[model samples]
Target: MLQHLKDHSNHEALQLQLFASTGEGITLYELESGKETFPFYLTKGTYYIRIFSNDQPMKYSFTSSFSKGDNFENELNNTKSTAKLMIPNTTFTGTLNDGGYDNQFADVDVYKFEL
Candidate 1:
């Protein structure tokens, strides 16, 4: 599963959008700011997503039955535990997992937005 966050300090309504590689592409989960959990179907491939908002210190998390890729060969490098991928003008905290496999990995995150 893939997770994304916005700048928590922005004080704006943020939308979390995610796509599963095995099931859908548009968005498997969509939620407003401060939502704890969002359920979505996961495919057996790479996935993509897009997050919108302008808040700093945002947080996110996800769960799926997919697997991680060889890229995570280094256990320490892999963010198995809850990770907070901080973005410019934003702070993000979330949990990402591959469900214990080596065939799926969601979008780690490209460019965070500020709107």
Candidate 2:
């Protein structure tokens, strides 16, 4: 999954950390600047996000799901109370063409071949 963070706050430096929930506690996944993007390979589960400024953590913690190929964008506004995180839905559409094979078996419309 790809996680992107944008810091719109007036603070010049912000500390952002990504944590994964475990059976015992939370595991630290990645720590980066608020203006940078983080990429992680995680299993299907939930995670905790924390953003800090001047060594003080934000009031509200963000939680999100981490599935395969998921992308997330988090924005930290200047007000500090109006932070937003966006999870976009990704959809794929395509057309399948069966090479005009009339002798195809039932329920077998697609065939795989190595070129």
Candidate 3:
């Protein structure tokens, strides 16, 4: 597919990553300021997203076509032991940062709900 990439940061380099609940990860896309962007796919079942930006003060907007995301996620919930407790139907949002200097990137974040 062919599409124009949006440059909210003067074409600063950017990356959009995808991770499956099973911990499967594959680089789906990189949308730079002035290039064409190809759409990526996400097969069903709990997914995680990580956005990396070369732009220091990166600014972007994300909207889901379907109501499948929460509005808040607590940080450091990157492991099973650190899993964040989730309340049913409540909105939660979180950010996954770049594997800066140490490359100690938290590849996945999990949330749990107790019955």
Candidate 4:
């Protein structure tokens, strides 16, 4: 049977809470390895996450953060290779700099801590 909710789900909130585990590590929901849905938690404030990868077959590292201001880059990497991120509290505009470009394409995965 299916369950019903009291109100429509928040799209942005749901995205922030998504995660994927790849045995080695965890990653965002959209980047998960397998076709299974993983669970994560989300709060009404700032959050940070880091992604690590194996080097034997590949090499890369990923670190990303989300907050409620224009200083998004301050919480993340200061390099060229980066990923697209949305600042959680201020209208969801702008991109965050996630360190390590190669990491994004590696076999690395992601996990959520506090959700």
Q: TM-scores of the models, in the given order?
A: 0.30, 0.30, 0.40, 0.19
Sorted on lDDT, best first, the list reads 3, 1, 2, 4
How many backbone collisions does model 2 have? 0
* lDDT assessment of candidate 4: 0.29
Clashing pairs in 3: 11-33, 72-92, 72-93, 73-93
Ten-residue stretch with the least lDDT total in model 4: 11-20
Tell me how far the alpha carbon of residue 89 in candidate 1 is from the true structure, in angstroms, after superposition: 50
Decide which is better by lDDT, 3 or 4: 3
lDDT by residue (73-92, candidate 1, tens digit) is 12122443533233465433
Q: For candidate 4, lDDT tens digit of each residue in 1-115?
A: 1111223232121121222242232234322231233332332444444432221232222333434444322212233333324434443232321222336543322211222
lDDT of each: 0.43, 0.36, 0.57, 0.29
Q: In order, how many clashes per candidate?
A: 13, 0, 4, 6
lDDT score, candidate 4, position 115? 22
- Candidate 2 lDDT over 1-115, as tens digits, reads 2222444355334444455575322222333333233344444577665555553443323434434443322221223344223324443221221222332222121222233
Model 4 misplaced regions, further than 4 Å: 1-36, 56-115
Stretches of candidate 1 above 4 Å error? 1-10, 20-25, 28-33, 54-115
Model 3 misplaced stretches (Cα beyond 4 Å):
1-11, 34-40, 66-115
Model 1 worst lDDT window (10 residues): 68-77
Clashing pairs in 2: none
